[model samples]
Target: MAMKSSPVVLKTWYVSIACIMLLSALLLFPVRISLASPAVLVVDDDGFASPTDCDGSDPAYSSIQAAIAAAFPGDEIVVCPGVYSEQVTIGRDGLRVRSFDGSAVDGTPDTVIQPGELTPAAVLITANGVVFQGFYIKDATTGTGHAHVHRGVFVQGDNNVILNNKVEGRGTCRFADVGILVRGGGVGNGVAENNLIENNEVTNTCNGIATVSIATNNAAAYTTIKGNTVKNNLGIGIAADRTPSALVGFNEVTENEIGLKYNSDSEKGLPATGTKFRCNDVYGNEIYDAQNIATDNSIMDAEFNWWGSNTGPDPSKISGSVDYVPWLTAPKEEGCPQKGRMTGGGVLRGEVLFINKTKVSATVNFGFEVHCNNEKEPNNLQINWRVGGQTFIFHLTAMNYAACFETAADQGMPPAPFDTHVGSGEGRLKIGPSPWTPATIQWMFVDDGEPGVGKDIFHAVIIADSTSYVISGKISGGNMQAHPDDP
Candidate 1:
């Protein structure tokens, strides 16, 4: 009877255990992972042990195409310094390929892809959000024609940044392509910013940088052609046709047969509209050449426009081997080329870097100062500064470059009241508030339309209760430049 009772109890215990296990499994079903998104792959010409190695791998792939073939959407394939003798095509969205190191030579013009060996381009992209930075693209002997027959970097995506890379030196084209051609591949929103096409020394090319008609209709809106140094090309150095409100600024186009040209409409005789050419130096262009007539071209708000045939001070003197300062003259130099020069102080030619700021308090104020060599007056050269965001444009002006400015949030307004102050400079001063929290600030020199300029030095002074705040900035819309921080 005792043995029978024990058996019955064991059976009951097993049934309870099974019921508990079933309940736990029902509550803890496995989930499926999402792998449909993009993946970042690696390619080292020298070879990598795995995809992770290619992320920053040494002895990289001998060919960039090899690495590109293995990439997916939202994938970043970083290539090491090597010679790739094949053409590469990137047709996926959110794909980015760059050099392992940040040095220009490391990725800029160093990772050479000879397109002659293949029938297509050295690097051809067709998806949105694809970024190609810091790579050298070239045409090989087997390459069709030097004008690339196509392009060094052909992008057809939106939100793409082709920055700090070199696309140069073409051979021939039965028709003509570009060194860097950006177009809308179906519905991509693309942009080309801060790229260096300098010393590319192109020849027999249609255009150094070409923005075509396809980009106009696609989602790739607002292309910015800035800070590019284009030289020695047969066709237009930079061309934007059928593009929507293209913004071309701060580009140096020199020694080209045709510096800058545009025709927004597809109809040959039609004219383009809504294009901007601001603060660019279009000097030493040979527009007199038969094949290079800058016809139906319109220019606005541009600073320096010196033609090669002009008998004036060489614009190259501003930043060249020769130190000759050309006399500023009105009108043209017999060749009908508009004569111009860098307005305002020579010290304005530098770059600006914004340090990130951390907001400590909801309502806070900030203060900052600028340093200068000379201190004189109520208005010698009008100094203009602008701040704020997309909705509001808060502007401030001063007569001297050595004054400080402050912004205090909680001190004014209501829930987020901010007080702003601008004054003379010297020593350690701050912008914003005391016991300050962090906020973003951007400042630059605005031209008040005057001449007889002297060199000016504008240094940024950050004052806060905490030194751990980060700040970021860039100089916009001025003939002057901001210097980069020392490495």
Candidate 2:
């Protein structure tokens, strides 16, 4: 009976013993992560360490330029595959070297680094939020006037983000070397965007992915080139010159004789007018082979892009001048191009020939000279005319494989054995009658011939070049005599 102490029940047992000692110090503490805020430094040419202590073992800072010189602004330097050999740079605050496992970089087929063994450009990144990804850089050797300025990823700095890396050997680059050489004052003003630089492949190198502009496009703006496939590169697969205002899309610039090259060294320095090149499939790229063509000036897609050029259309003409059309369901072994691809001589009706260079008078104005390489689809086209022996019963509502009907008919006339039996596919062409013009003519069913033996037998003229004519002789009845003055 001596207990009388009640200071409000000892202030509720001292606040329930300080809430159970703050839940047992939040279940035993030790989760404090913030290496001075946003850190991840890790290097390895064998367990490296520069200013050491980003933790993970430290072998005296293995080397990503000595852990990026002791990292700072949003630090993150993984780097571990090996063979760094070194040319290092990446200055100006902002780091991200990556590759602890995300995989991608080949720099030149798995890291080689020998531009005279080092001092070239193993990987000089100059920062501004730097982000280099994957890895693979090669021999790089240069000297013929900075020998293309060696690059495996030589970005100058400014919002940099060189992703998916795999730069090739520069093959003795003369002076504009590139694997990924983004330039322009203060590192092209940043914003290299999403960055996949995909599949990562490059060769010979003069430009695999270049974006120069030391002083244009008002100091270079938005850069976003997508997908990136660029093969064979001697001059371009993805190039944006001194006028740099890049935004090229999808990216699959094939065979590379020059798939996407836009320049402006001194055309008064233009470019920056919206700049957007879409979809991208860009074919074998010979750009129309005039010895690797130079000034045709379509300057990469003014829109969309397909220009592989197989052409057709314009059947008997009426309007259709080509803007792009050749996908014909795509798959006749995949070379399947056909919406239009026409060229020379065409007149598929009971084709049989004779046009008065004195070759026996069947010249009632039967013309054929097609050369329409499809400016478009010229109304899809169709030219049927089966007359007598029906040429395998004629049935070609026009699918246009460049419309063929050859047997050579204009002066020097002779070529109409049913246009060589339907152009070797052994079909079509066999019309009959009309020696003195009663208007039923078209022939070719010869075999001891004359006056209805097998029936159809005029089979007009439809020749295709390389001159060497002969179809079993005799088609010269002295101008079909009914008296061209008693020939």
Candidate 3:
């Protein structure tokens, strides 16, 4: 979205394989996901395309809706790579519908859900405590229904999670409303409270993300919209009001009409009386970065944010009573980030390796860091690997992995990016995701050879967690440089 920030860090902390200390933090901030389900329902587009295209004899479900219909309350559904042409709904509590091999990285998305026919939305949630992740949801502009009902991803349930997905072009056809909406007061739906909408990209809609209530006050309360990029929408990037005490934090809001807004429903007469916006990157809006048309003219807490200017937000860019003091001089950098990725502690650059002459495997082009090394630090590691047709992309924050480098004066090595380095550390080993699925893995690497001349090494072992691999490998192919830290 043309962000001016060079480094993006959002303070992510859901990692660590070295320390038994992470076990305590896991308990303190436990995601409501219980892997103790009866069975995992697998959905793939290999033999199915539509909701009814399931190959019953093949055992795998054909459509997302079919899996939901047959799933139990706590069951987890894993969907493979495909562009699904149907709308989805969930009525079962605690059911997780996730795309198989996708993270927050747009290069490799979870699954694609572009509804063929026009409906109210691409996905609808009336269930509580459901986890919807890893999908690229868009082209859902299919209805003339109410603003609340017409969205890319709409939620009327409580404690639900919307993570690591990209939602764009949502209300283009009819109600230009919201890309993702979390509202309360649905007749049969549960109260939309304490819902976490994190690590998602919302753009090209009327509004990016919103938490609201039409039934009564506090119906859609305490929504946490964090670690997301909200930009290029027609109206508000993030709208939190009508419902009370909603938090909009650690997000990048740019290139929109309004970066952040208070709920302005003249019909309901809700003036966004109580909302808190903090620690966000807000700028590049065509109109205003933050527009608070609160009828009450009450003071809103809009502090700790990066408002495109080190001095502070421009007076004309923000409206109403907003307290925007003590702002960040630069973009926020933590575990997870608002813009440019906060990569690993060291720099990892490499070339490709073709094993069988035809198969393109072992191609590494990424920067990784170990923020999971300490208990209090964020788990932010970014690694990209390709074996055959499969690529594993995950990232952690602040302190997970650790490594050291040998410079020219220190052991006669090359400078920074071209230095000889070796190190090993433990971490949860995920790229871009929630803490729900953590894999305990330890890894080691050596970049001791010349860049482009070959001889870089990489290896990993699944010492703990799920039953996966007792792995090892040898490599000597590179012109790439590896550093223990930035040059």
Q: TM-score winner among the candidates? A: 3
On lDDT, the leading prediction is: 3
Q: Can you rank all candidates by TM-score, best first? A: 3, 1, 2
Write model 2 residue lDDT over 1-487, tens digit each, in one string: 6988899989999888998887665443312235684677666655643323333343434556776777777777776656666777778466777655534543233433344533336677656667777666665454554533556765555556666666675564355667776654444443332222444556667667766564542344445566566777666667655433355555566666566665444445544323444434556654421111112232322232333432421222111121223221221212212122221212222123222222321212121222112122321211233323332112122221121121222112232211111111111222344221111111221212222222212242232221111122333321210000101
Q: Please give the lDDT score at residue 201 for candidate 2.
A: 55
TM, every model: 0.50, 0.26, 0.57
Please give the distance, in angstroms, between residue 34's alpha carbon in candidate 2 and its true position after superposition. 6.6
Q: Which parts of model 3 are misplaced by more than 4 Å?
A: 1-36, 48-58, 117-119, 140-149, 170-174, 187-190, 264-274, 334-487
Name the lDDT of candidate 1.
Answer: 0.44
**Compared with the true structure, what per-residue lDDT tens digits does model 1 show for residues 257-374?**
6676654443443233334443345666666211212234433222223333334444432221211122112222221111111112332222232223433211111122222211
Ranking of all predicted structures according to lDDT, beginning with the best and ending with the worst: 3, 1, 2
Q: Which ranges of candidate 2 are over 4 A from the true structure?
A: 1-71, 77-92, 101-131, 135-199, 202-208, 212-217, 220-229, 232-236, 243-257, 260-262, 267-487
For model 3, how does the per-residue alpha-carbon lDDT over 76-183 read when each residue is reduced to its tens digit?
A: 888877788889988799998888754634678647888854245688888899999989986754444434534778888888999999987754524556778888
Error of 2 at 128 (Å): 2.7
For candidate 2, the TM-score is: 0.26
**At residue 49, what lDDT does model 2 achieve?**
34
